[model samples]
Target: MMKLDFDDWNIHVGAPHPFNARAVPKIDNGTERPDPRRYHDPDFMREEWDKVFARSWLLAGPASDIPEAGDFFTFTIGPESFIVVRGEDGVIRAHYNVCPHRGSRLVTADFGSMDRFTCPFHSWKFDLEGRNLAVTDEETFRPEVLCHGHDLTSVRCEVAVGLVFICMDTDVAPLSQWLAPILPQLELYDIDKMYVVQHRRSDWGANWKGGVDAFAETYHLHAVHPQTQGLMDDRTQIDLWPGGLSRQFVPFAQPASRYPDQETVNPGIQSMLSDAGVDPNEYRGTAAEARHTVQQAKRRRSDELGLGYDRFSDSQLSDSVVYSLFPNVQIGCHPEAIFLHRFLPHADDPNQFTYDTCILYRHVDAPGYRAPAWMGLAEGTDMSGGTRPEVVHTPLGAPPGLGEVLDQDSDLLPIVQAGARSRGFRGPLWSEQEGRLRHFHAELDRRMTAP
Candidate 1:
């Protein structure tokens, strides 16, 4: 018999980050169940934005999305708008979206290449470096205010793991410092080189935190995504880190303990074997043997296809790692793809929020490669679709092709939002699995009052 270690690949695994030295925090204090008003109260939403969203390093967009100079995207959080663009020097920067002359928006489109940005209202112009180049009537205004470098108010911006992160607080720490604990896991996969195969955004009637609560735990999967019960281990192992970061290492291709008759091959195991290039119908082993078999099969398959995943251990080949960034981002990292979902507070409505999801892949040319169906991909469908990516926009509750598992969550989240108002409902009760949610709110509280 063996006590299998699910992590550590026996390769050049680096020492744990200094922040990971302590044990993960528990939900012991009165902080377990947060006050429900934080979800739908207008004042609370405003307070959170001022304290959390305004100061945190939020995921703006991917650097790969804006590769060439002049490539840019608009990220709107709360009432503020920012433009993330590649400067002439091939560096990425973010600037406030207001025109210096009349306070009108400078860039109007979601994304595009522009030689420079010109305000539509007064035609004030600025280059990609946010340098003021021209103004329709420069002589009309006082020279002091004019010479004050009205270009575009530059906001704090930096790049990490191919994603652009911007902070409204100019004095905020660098991205690396803000995200130290999770850096090792991010570098494990060379995500900066990956391509965005699918991008989606939807407006939901749930508060931003409410939306975060929904995706933060796997406890809901049994009731909401019943179809996945037999395929994944629902009882997950969670790890918490400093700077309000947490991770849940989810085991895949294994049946839940709830499933009886573990010795015989189940349909889920059979499907996993067949997808890994093993003939499940020809497999002479029991269901319990499927995980080991699939691991070896995928490793051999990766070598045969020339996929460059030398840094990944066999356990990482099929298991899923879900990471939660403070304020409002949840990511599911898999060997095949990175599932990133970002939630933002609705500008005016406390009960509404917007979610943006991006699924990035390595863009390998292997024909036998298959993205897991849980990714909402159909059989035989090319995940790349020629690798030229385009984000599909849908209102909340629409099927964004994220597979049946999350599709169920999409349909039920709105109702969950409405349920928050029921007088009969108390605040959330924390189980050990949902400790990440408590840690998230604890950080928010700390930041709200922390000098």
Candidate 2:
């Protein structure tokens, strides 16, 4: 299923590519101690708002979330808000969440469907295409004021590999230009057809950068989520890219170096095999063989089973090639499903942030079939069984807060935040393996300080 190159790509199936590139400057922002104020200073947070959050392109949600005309969802980050909507003509667009009339917030709920958005305060209406349809008191207001081009202030929106992204600022480069080097890598797993099966949002006690930092490197993996030791080799291999985007390749379905016996199948491998819809007992090979076995099985049966996993390579199927988009999105590109995380800053506090998690799987109606084991869903579970998928929200630091692995992170991040301000505490000294962290902060520093 893996092509030697992307030459034979059918845009409908594979992402067409000449793989345009944005140059990544050789820079290291990680050699020095990360300023502790980045986690808690109000002034630093303001700088981030004006420079980073306001200008960068952000992942609103999947295009599949609003599959029908007039369906829409609201994505709010920091103080900015936008609505990603599917138009009557089937085009996906994003509009600012403010009414042009009185500046009252237009869309209240997280998601809904409508022919037009009627301002609750003054009843000024706008169509799904963001056209200013009707004014409450048309006769009183002069035509000069009403026709002054106050259509729902459209935000810059673009779609790639199925995600709807919005840019708050008006002057940044196009999304494609920003996504240059990272786009082709993401194209490996066809994302346009995938549907979100699990959506979980949780507010964390740490800063947004802290949340992003935790997932960027695996150096903390053996310490924070010790139970996950053998699930994969967590010694992270950081792959730097242009525009602060990078990836960490962690070998999956294989035991970590610390595991006692690499010859036999570890408990982690057995659990993974069972979760992947493969019977570990039925596997007649060693633990090293389990990963390839699942990869080959998934590739061979993808079309027959209706799960479109044939696009991924054996390495992609078993290992975690987590592609991190600049600023706040972390995309875990897997063979069967894609794991995503969006870290949002708090409206007022730099010390607090929210972590939004979504797991998207290839949608199929086949019975007795299972998606990737990462979601902890029952083996052979049909996520498409329901009319629509439901997003489950849970408070962090609670039982079943996005499952066990995340629960550990949830508990630890808050403590890390508390320690950040300790009188004796010094700044963090990252190891070479966490060079991705240095690369990210380097880009962030450039962006924040750039004119």
Candidate 3:
């Protein structure tokens, strides 16, 4: 019996690779067990809203979602709703969604195009830049009541690497500083050129932090998402940076170390090869080498198709480089496409949160260019950016249509939430594999316990 090359489950264990070496440092996040109460306690949730969400630069949506002037969308966090719109000046701005007159919500739709926002109740209109355009019966109101100027309250809005971000704390650091660690790597994909092909939001019965924890680590993949074992490597390369940011590089187009057969090219690997324009039957390497082979093939195919893959390293071409943006967003970066997942806290309930998933793909005229098979985009998805799909809202118990792995997470997370409330459950005993979770909770503790 021959010992396998990956039998020890240790890969990328020594020095930091050139790709992520810049962000990796010897910052020690103490290994204290995280309190389970933070997941279900209402008071803790409230504290997070005040300290964490309120102060952090949150991902609003992809900038590609609103390309033209007057294009707008809404993002709600806790009790506040924001209108993120592209002004006529081609600047992206965020405004409080309330009408100044009576606090009526100016826009109810998830996305729309409008020259100005008009309140349905009092018919107060505001321009795309959120300036007051018209106030119905303006003479009736006293000047003192309108002394503050009836403009929609604006927040700090910034665009970086093709994503829109808004921060309520005006004094907070610039978005670039907040995203400094991962910005350079994110730029390699040219995500700004990509367009959203699918977007969906679903209500889940779990605290927002709990939802973040679930997606932040792959430690639970063996138990919760067994189906992915054949396609994903559980031995992930975890990298931590300052500001609660972390990422895991999970090898794709390969089987986990625990898989019984390492030599066979499974269907998942075959699909990956086929998507990269490689013929599975012609593949002669072992399952582990499929990733590298696909990387080479993708580079060759990309050059033939005139697609951009030169900036990306070979590993990035075949692995899942998922980055967890502090507080709420997880981005899975790829050369051909990217996956954006946001876990938004429910306004009133600590035990409820909204899970938003958006799949973006760069359009290429070459028929050979295909997004990763793992993206699981449904048939007839509009990759051309001609049509922005309406946001689909799935109820708490219904299917989120987020494909196999995430839908499995949707089903399992609420159960985990329920277990967290049990008297016997003390706290999570995180392993080295779950360092990202520990890193996130450490940052959460730092913010929540700050003076």
TM-score of 1: 0.89
Score every model by TM-score. 0.89, 0.88, 0.95
Q: Tens-digit lDDT track for model 1 on 125-232?
A: 999988899988878889888877687898888898988899988778898987886887787777797767777777777888887888888777777877666777
Candidate 1 vs candidate 3, lDDT winner: 3
Per-residue lDDT for 401-436 in model 2, tens only? Answer: 577888788888889999987866676787676777
Order candidates by lDDT, high to low.
3, 2, 1
RMSD of each: 5.0, 6.6, 3.4
Once fitted onto the true fold, the runs of candidate 3 whose alpha carbons sit more than 4 angstroms away are 1-10, 13-17, 20-22
Better model by TM-score: candidate 1 vs candidate 3: 3
Backbone clash count, each prediction separately: 2, 0, 0
lDDT, candidate 3, 1-451, per-residue tens: 9934431453562223468453446556876987889988888888889999999999999998899999999998889999999998999999999998889999999899988999999899999888898888989989998887899999999999999999999888999998888899899889999999888889999988889888888778888888888878888777788999988888899888787778888899999999888999998999877888888988898788776677677778888899999989999998889999999999979899999999999888776687887788888787788999988899988888888888888898899899999998988988777788899999999998888
Cα-based lDDT for every prediction: 0.76, 0.77, 0.86
Colliding residue pairs in candidate 3: none
Q: lDDT score, residue 286, model 2?
A: 75
